[model samples]
Target: MIPVPTGARVWLATGYTDMRRGFPWLALQVQEVLRKGPLSGHLFVFRGRRSDLVKMIWHDGQGACLFTKRLERGRFIWPSVAGEAVTISPAQLSYLLSGIDWRNPARKPASDAGRIAAFTV
Candidate 1:
């Protein structure tokens, strides 16, 4: 899990992005396109054109860190249109990274309701 600073926000860049871009390019996007400073310490998430991979960039005081995740069996959920970033909670980010639908983070039971674990019961 990526640790979020005290009150820093997570901004998801809407639409698809070219994953070929590196830190410098992505950072510039944060400033020019997203209209936010890359060094502001806010987490920025960008999805690839195929929606199966995503890149996250954030400044961790000393320097910037870039993290990437690709799903093997499912595509990452993302908004359709472009423009304006989406702010999501850290918990939602966790859901997203785990290949779950972050837009509506929910867990589905792995077994029948009648077979509930004795401990959970």
Candidate 2:
């Protein structure tokens, strides 16, 4: 698992982003559109319109890092709203990348009756 430093924020850019955009362009989106600095050491995540691809950009004091993930089967779960930013924990991010719904994760080991509650991802 990727470790997240204490107090570091993970920002998810709601809706879709153009996957063709590289660091500089995506950084610009973070700064201008998200109203946040790209080099601010905070994690910024972007998802493509197809919902199967996601790109993450972050500055780790040394340099910028970009991570991309694409699902071979199901599409990535995303917020339905547009033009908004949501903050998530590193653990939730891990769940999201695992192709599981990060919002209402499955409750394990106790009962077989499956019930889920909706929450923002």
Best candidate (score: TM-score): 1
Candidate 1 CA-lDDT value: 0.91
Clashing pairs in 1: none
Candidate 1's displacement at residue 78, Å, is 0.8
Backbone clashes per model, in order?
Answer: 0, 0
What is each predicted model's overall lDDT from 0 to 1? Answer: 0.91, 0.88
Stretches off by above 4 angstroms in model 2 are 108-121
Candidate 1, TM-score vs. the true structure? 0.88
Q: Across residues 1-121, which tens digit of lDDT does each residue of candidate 1 receive?
A: 9989889999999988899998999999999999999999999999998889999999999998999999998988887768778999898898889888888877667777658566653
Full-model lDDT, candidate 2: 0.88
